[model samples]
Target chain A: MVSDLSVLLTDRQGQPYSLTSERIKHLEYLCESTRRDIVDTLYKIGRGHAGPSLSMVELLISLYFEELRFDPSDPKWPDRDRFILSKGHGSLGYYAVLAQRGLIEKRELDTFESLGSRLQGHVDSNWLPWVELTTGSLGQGLSYAVGVAIAAKRQAKDLRAYCLLGDGECQEGNVWEAAMSAAKYRLDNLLAIVDWNNLQGGVTLEVMPSLEPFALKWQAFGWHTIEINGHDLQAVLQAYHQARQTKEKPTVIIARNIKGKGVSYMENKVEWHGGTVTKELHQIALEEINARLSELSQYADEKYGRNHG
Target chain B: MANWKKAPIREALGKTLVELGDRYPQVLVVNADLRNSVKSIYFMEKYPDRTIEVGIAEQNMIGVAAGLASLGFIPFAVTFARFASKRAADQISMSVDYCRNNVKIIGAYAGIFTGAQGVSQQMIDDTAAMRAMPNMTVIDTADVHEVRSALLFAAEFSGPVYIRIGRDEWPVVFDETYTFELGKGRWLREGSDVVLLNSGILLPYAVEAAELLESEGISAGVVNMPSIKPIDAALINDISRNVGAIVTLEAHNVQGGFGSAVAEVTAANYPVPIEMIGLRNEYSESAPNDALLEKHHLNPPWIAAAAKRALDRKNRLRC
Candidate 1:
């Protein structure tokens, strides 16, 4: 079933852009493999961060594979684009992407949360590559991203910064501060994506809802707004393509997602937000994820030919 | 050996920043609607492109400063001490200090010396809070000379720095030729009977206390320990050895300001008979500037009296 998943995509010209789709499929595979890697590592060490990782799988794939201009080989490449995981709890997605991209050794993924692993429960730039800022406290990453964006603009550098925020985390006052500043400066080179997975820890996003016409808020704040289905790889790629044409205002891709999209029992369940994967539950999750992988691969084959062909 | 003259440190800081702006284009200043109050008006006027006025938003101002710092720019974030310390503390902790950003925080109207504005506006504990943070350089310039030197030093130094400047007209204590070194204490009036350790605007009162002690035949040594975080422990140890007892003075809360730092060091390393002369845990209710200092027992006479009391206590304990 895992073997059936294929990578395929389309470009801006509306032509059959197979490389984009293929890379995205690889990204999703990276997410699944790394998801298991993170869960197993977390289980061995402790518990607290799987649901957030699961929700941001497709979003991370689209950014890493389609949008960002980063060299995994040279993480500190000066001219390289910056990516900030504002919702740091979803760092497992980032770690998996980094590992698959060859930024870090695949073996290093197993050591996550160990006595001295660089893969902390939260993202720390001190340990990882391409992580622009060390974020865990929430609401501060957007501000940091704004700073990086402003610097890039002031220097007239071609480099851009992309920051990913969790919908639950956007309620922080500092996020608005950053949003206001990003618009005021006309930071077109900056892009902010919200992982609008409708669940927070131990409660639904509806309970503590920051969801009244959310995309309009960014539009009102002078940002180029783009809302899409987060789980749809094609939609995610399309949003990124459109954001590039944005001239004066910063772009916000508010990707609506589920807490646990693929796994059956975990879907939209707040309990999965930060829970440990028990061996029994882990097996069930693997089976469910395997089924989804096959479904994705079938969709890819119907849309585009096989990778070799 | 040190220059002892009258220069307001706040003015020197402004001058030094203006010069720095000329030298480095990346030197940016973000004012929290306190451009004139903190004397950053010069930087704003001189380099309009580099200066940002965040309009009374201390939290956003600090957040912006931290962001700018992360992007390899030297951002001097300025605001009145009260707002910078009390209001924008979270941003300081998360964005600037925790992230180890090269951001400098210039605090004006620090302490009760903000004249008749009362305790509501006057920040007396900004230095102490800044000092408590990791990798933070907390400085209180003695005079205009030291302020100039401190600005240059902060520019060269990496990581976070907090400079507390007085709002009222403060008498210049350091001379034009005075040298300011990072983490080093300056010994002004050296004596053996008692040691008066102080920093910021209170250093002037400490000098006056030394003169009064001399008139009474009490050899009081006055040390200007401005950099509060990486405290002058060597000087503290030397004072404990040379002077019989020690008296710490500052126009701040006795609870955690300069005096509290000195007490913590001296008590742990060498238990000396120490007297702390500062505000008596009471908020100011808009009194005349000088009257408030006298009322809080932070004036020269009060400091001198405290020194003598400490000396007597040391002698009594020795007996």
Candidate 2:
């Protein structure tokens, strides 16, 4: 129960680089299943975010399954690492991770976007305080994370704050304001991840006022930047590790990913940011994700044993 | 007129914070680098670790406050009224109000008394803007003592609260015994002809106007309204029905501020003749506080004059 982040990260539960082949396979399985779950859930709901939700599946899976500390039994665990989805529009992905980790009841997933549902379209903190901050508007969650990190540091608490923002959200001036504060305070326990799919509102960021030299932007703001392929589980885990090792400054991981990573027709499609998933499109998506799942299943059987989840 | 006590309302916050930090360690102040002007430096001097100065970034200051609030800390996000209500309005609206976070938004230099920082700095619409927000408890305490009382009350309040304080020292209306509560108005005077509905630093002006009206044979009552959002609708309805006429005063725009709030309540519950004395629908120029007050017609003379007008309307309507 010591309030030390180094102790939190390097504990016997498992360190960053210690990812075994079986653990990687398990994470991959979680990723495919999460994608299938998102597509299934969005299909039933008939209209929910698909593109932005589809892009960051691995990014969220690694953090919940392999990174970040928390007890699902106690959402208010004082020592738990905090997570905020700054790109709250892409909430289906975050919800999948929460369900996969058993942080939320799996049956509750179907009630998303329904009247009085706990799982709001954009993340809500009302019923689920573990969500930390209710953020549908972009560019606000980073500053909130900065506040949480400052509070944790001030109290010498081991709780680390993590905020995931969209690449488009970086255009907001509020993000940089928070960045300056985090750097000025040299908050090493704070980590900001930009899901750098370079696509927002159905247009490539290059077409819009682009985020060219994005990593250098964080560096100029005095952050330790880690650029990586977001879908790669090992890279995502290592990025989390590198962020932990950096001292005297905050870290930003520019996770390069596709707008729609798993689905064929939806892959990199600009319209899919919140594009509706039709019955035909849903079937294709599940088929594609299941194909990946079966391959990971065979590998798990070879390395370890038959897996149930 | 005997010279009344005058003290800076802005000083009470910092002084109280110093003590508040000692008592409630979870209480923190998020600053936008106007610590000296807003007198938050007093708290910083005592508890440096408790102050999170965001250095001139209002949006980040609010967002940081929301974050701290999410972590169950009482964060008073302090900045100029323009920055708190206008510049970062969305941040406050979405992050603080919509999220219903337990954060105190402190808008300093809230009126024409911005020490000649002028047009850009003088924020007259803060009361209007903040009061328009849902789930936000808007309070503009009248004096230094009431400001301290409100701050102490805010520590106990759970939802988002917007507290507006003027910059320079002005006339103090209430004594140290005046306690603050949400959605309540205290009657400063009781008159049958007309009522002066006032909020914020203009309380003394309304009081003075009531006294002046008494000198003239016009019986003008004064009611100090510290809470604006959960406004004193019951008191306002009582005045409108029984007192017959109302003259509303604030150091803000007359459109959607304290005056309009009264008008809205009376229009629905008990309709009456309401005269508003504050900034007309226009921007104010940079000038000395007194000059700005004089130019905006928010001084005691203008308030007394407005009350007379309301009395005239009341008598005419009766006939």
Candidate 3:
């Protein structure tokens, strides 16, 4: 059944996202394809953050493909929902998703960190106009996101602001200051998602100043907290929807992610956070990811109708 | 308005901001609990809805202002100069400057020894610190009139601006006809012997020193350089050509403040014998304005002495 694709997939104002077998299958394809592109690109680039980039693949896929509303053609469209990549080292993953939407060109992707590549090591708004906030330093994006949300509300516009921050990024005092102000303003339209990968520079959170009582901390800051497995697409979508409906307060989704997810050897390996993906290891990782594609595709078709041939 | 009636520069900022709000609907103020002291409270009283109280968080205040600027609202983020420069430097660099967000950062009680708030509060590095950041326009108005003009200038001007203002009521230097032009300096007095180029509240001293030099047969010119960064190099070059000696002044460290900018201008083109008059590579003590000014040789008599020293160096260079 072909449905009208014009309405935004974000909220009740648009066609709210429902979990059908075919839709889930398409989202899963996007997730896996995004990971493949990232791994491929990072391999070519010779140097990049792979683990943190890999950890947030599903989240970015869910945001760009289904939840966050935007027109790729008119990127600077006023009233378009804004997204802040506060965890700026995750630029490769962001660039991959943006490329899928065809926002970033192939040449730009090839020249990722090299000269003339608009895509800097960190997210740069000067290079990418729609980047919203060119973030690299942690704990600042949520404040920018809150400001955006405040501006939207003041203008009586329905556009929302979303920020994706690393687990380690939350340790910044600015984040809590932003959190306190966001709560004070009762910014219902502002949603922050923490990539709770439990690692900072390959060290466990326990060793670092831990975000151990993380959820309660947000709760204490008067935020509606949603804890979920970061890799779970269904829970991710549900958390986003709940956040949109929540009023009189801001919402935070503590996506407990693995620093290096998906590929067997890389998964949960702290060292892979900054380690190089050799050509030998790249091939093995691709095969591991490739092996799951057909099985998931068949299972999706068996459970529900097919979205594509 | 009395010609020399001392009024708070922050008050001028607050009053003018309200006028800006009346005209520009997109104008907003982001305060970190310094409204009463910084005098953004005037704008706050007039437009409470437009004022965003971030509650004493400087970094978050800047980020929020950037966010607002991103969405087309012009946000004036106000905080003490020291906190804004040092505490939120990275945020200003990453979120505002690098992103090219059109936000106005008001640094209050900057480099003023009269603050009594302690040496920690009096910031001598705000100009030096902000001047280093790319895409930041630094403006240090000398009085109420210039502060008023600066607020008007900042509203119409696009991109990031760092405006240094004083917390307490201070002396007025400019008249009613005074208008602000960024990247330009107004030559207040024409003296061939020596010229004192200065910005912020120290312009009166420069003028008084120039008058004192005239009595001593020393033609001392005075240049009000409000636009600190992207400084008027041509004016400095022209003035340097006419004058034998030059003195650059600010309530900041001579290392990277107003003096360094003037020296860079002349150094690049026509190198001149410049005696930079400022805090002599040291921290300022929390004292009365008169004591600090007198102690630091920033008052008129000391300024005249410095100009003579510069003249002596110029004479020595000729010899």
Instruction: Indicate the worst ten consecutive residues by lDDT in candidate 1 chain B.
Output: B1-10
Q: Pick the candidate with the highest TM-score.
A: 3
lDDT of 3 at A229: 94
Most accurate candidate by DockQ: 3
lDDT by residue for model 1 (B228-283), tens? 87899888987887675998877677788888888888887888998987776767
Task: Output DockQ, candidate 1.
Answer: 0.49
The value of fnat for model 2 is 0.80
lDDT of each: 0.77, 0.84, 0.84
lDDT of 3 by residue, A1-309 (tens): 533334223442555444664566667776776777778888888877888998998898788766777777887999799999999989988998888656777456778888877888888888887688888888899999999999999989989999999998888999999999999999999999999888877877788876779999999999999999989877787788789889999999999998778788877777877757889999998998787776566533323422211
Instruction: After superposing candidate 2 on the true structure, give the runs of residues whose Cα lies further than 4 Å from its correct spot.
Output: A1-17, A299-309
For every candidate, give the share of true A-B contacts it also has.
0.48, 0.80, 0.92
Global Cα RMSD, each model: 3.9, 4.0, 3.2
TM-score head-to-head 2 vs 3, winner: 3
Candidate 3: stretches off by over 4 Å:
A1-12, A105-108, A298-309, B1-3
Clashing pairs in 2: none
DockQ per model, Cα: 0.49, 0.68, 0.85
lDDT (tens digit, per residue) of candidate 2 on B1-319 = 5377778667776787777787788899888998888888988888788889999899999989887886778998877888878888989898889889899988888877878876888888988888889899999877788888888888888999998888777777767787898899989889999999988888887888888888998889988888998998898988988988999888888998999999999999988888998889988988887787788888788888998888898899999
Rank candidates, TM-score, best first. 3, 2, 1
